[model samples]
Target: MNDSLHTVSLIKIALYSAFAFVLSVITVVFITPFFPESAHDFLRFLAEVGIVLAVSLFIVRHLNKKDVSLRSIVGDTSVSKKMLLFSSSLTIGKLILYFLFAGLVLRFFITQPEFAADAQSVMEDTSPPEFNRWLIISTVVLAPVIEEFIFRGIILNKWAEKSSNTRALIISSLLFGLLHIGSFIIPQFIGGLLYGIVYIKTKKLIYPILMHVLNNLIPVGIMLIPAPESTEAFSVSQLIAELTPVLNVVSLVFIIALPVFLFIVYRYSRNLNDEVAPFKFNTRKAI
Candidate 1:
């Protein structure tokens, strides 16, 4: 505990993440032997309770830490038009960045032979109707709630108290990305960065949580769109050209609109003083 808060928070993040993942894996291993596939799948979902439980523990421990309390996560969230405008613009900005990074990876970096497995895995993840529904719900709903609380609420909150908000953003975002395997890590990290910034500027947990949910929904929405059935097979590049013209258009618009969004964010962030204390109890905080 004498260590720098950033260091301490980082270690705790790794420990709890590993604990949850190992427990989930163990649960899957145990259930695979005794239960049918569907039953095991459902049990696997419950295994995620380990993460939820672990996060709850983090919340308590973090709150009890000296000079820190619950205020790090919760803040003023007035339902005024100004707040709504900031939220909407922040949400769309994050989405644009999300697609920008993802498209860059797909269009250029993923073309390498080394990434063939990664690319193939992405394509093969084509959704079945019912399972995709549950998957979307889990990713878009459960994930945002659980993850925003854990990353933005607990990890970033703790770090912000211990360090500057900028450090908190970078550290927590890196940890967020590392939670995933393979190519997922980069985009997830980028998302964590944007989410953390929004949480800092608005001091509103809902904005980041909403952004997380929206980010997840992007991929799911893409999957749900019925692809035009074709007899001829296409290479990844050709398929990208065919299926994702909208992504390119959006990326272009994102480039054009990014400065405008930043101006709006800056206007809102005029009073975002990082030196202010981060975690404390406030009974009537707006955000």
Candidate 2:
């Protein structure tokens, strides 16, 4: 594409993303109140997903002069055994680090009474069972795909055109972190930063998608596991105190295995790069 055309495409993508974000915020703030809390929450989640997908598809199609499909984003290459191994290794590594940070570090430092109050205020509403199901789906599936497409696929790609890969990664990562503002902001920011690193290392949206899916799935998976019931709400300190012994053991094991997992990811990513190079070269030539 010509410089003028590329510039125009970049602008359009930015505008569309901005519009989608604004629309999502508005829907959450305003439209949610008109319906029952649970139904409203569910609808809002769906609306956000729909808006993002629609906007992204529309902008990419108009700018690139081609249809934007999942296949396009995921690429046409077969998932080789090596790629699977790498993805799995990287995913496991990420989960371990995430748990260390979220379950241990953040949980320890950010456990002030004010922080707990703020967190409670944000989660004030009692979402219905159906809403909870939709929330889970949105978080675990739709969110990971759509967000990776926008942040890594579009934003990072665009920035990489005009800057070094490292610079692009940092900028995109910061934007990703900033985008997570509100309740749960700290953990979200840390998650974004970690995903950014994964994106930089793998140079594929899939790495971050896997990381994201695992991040969301871990909590959802925990919720699925049966636990002893208690009538009273558990304080942050109480929960931490209860889990400290188990968390310590898990952390030690993860720390020991992390380096090996990182090495596997590095090798896997290299293989993926080798496989993708020829396709990228051909695509460039065709363009």
Candidate 3:
């Protein structure tokens, strides 16, 4: 019956996700036709920024009015060596996990025709360099901040009030995936789950944001690399081997260490601050 959990039921989660999705789709359907083809990407990006920001901020503000406070989610925590290692390891693990799964999908499931079309779709990013630059900045910087604030800082924290950390993490992570609602759903769902766990463990918004930024930047960096058509023939394994043996070694290390790191993080997260009093801001309403 706590206030934080009151506004954040499974029903509310579904409803919020539906609202955001419908609104985004409606906005796109109505607005995109009016824009000239040349400026569509830029305009769509702008619309997305405005809509997602407005919607998320409004929802977060209303949720914060309940038992969940910004202070609790933002919990005065500083970056440390442990946090850095944890974030780095988790990010690396996520990359390896995603690629490994993608490799399997590409290897066994997607037919030659599908692969050819996929490669074409991937290669056809004919956007100007300037547009690519803006896209990178928006995804790498803005996405982390906005997404972490809403999914972790607001929704996850609120759910945690009356549920186990595991339940809250699952709910928030799924909600995060729901927001993507396309080809992004699977990877984002995995990333969201890991980020949720990181947020719960670190008890800080910055760590998840940092992890998200780093995760996103990896793909952008890869995209900036020149990929010739010849390379398209390489399977994921061949590609990995050809790219760098060192990366495989690193991935192996992360795969082995993922469980150990998760255990350590879980242990650290379970330690309550019973001895030290909870942080208090100026007003009772704030906490």
lDDT of each: 0.65, 0.61, 0.65
Clashes per prediction? 5, 0, 0
Candidate 1 residue spans exceeding 4 A from truth: 1-17, 61-72, 76-78, 100-133, 181-184, 230-287
* lDDT tens digits by residue: candidate 1, 1-79: 1212342354665677677778788867876888876676566666665666776677567546733434444555455
- Provide the lowest-lDDT 10-residue window in model 1: 277-286
Report the C-alpha displacement of residue 202, candidate 3, in angstroms: 2.2
Model 2 TM-score on a 0 to 1 scale: 0.65
Encode model 3's per-residue lDDT on 109-137: one tens digit a residue.
34455655565565566554443565677
Error of 2 at 62 (Å): 3.9
Off by over 4 Å in 3: 1-35, 60-68, 104-133, 184-186, 228-287
TM-score, one value per model: 0.69, 0.65, 0.65
Better of 2 and 3 by lDDT: 3
Look at candidate 1 and tell me the lDDT of residue 21.
78
RMSD of each: 5.6, 5.9, 6.1
How far does residue 138 in candidate 3 sit from its true spot (Å)? 3.3
45 in model 2: Cα distance from truth in Å? 2.7
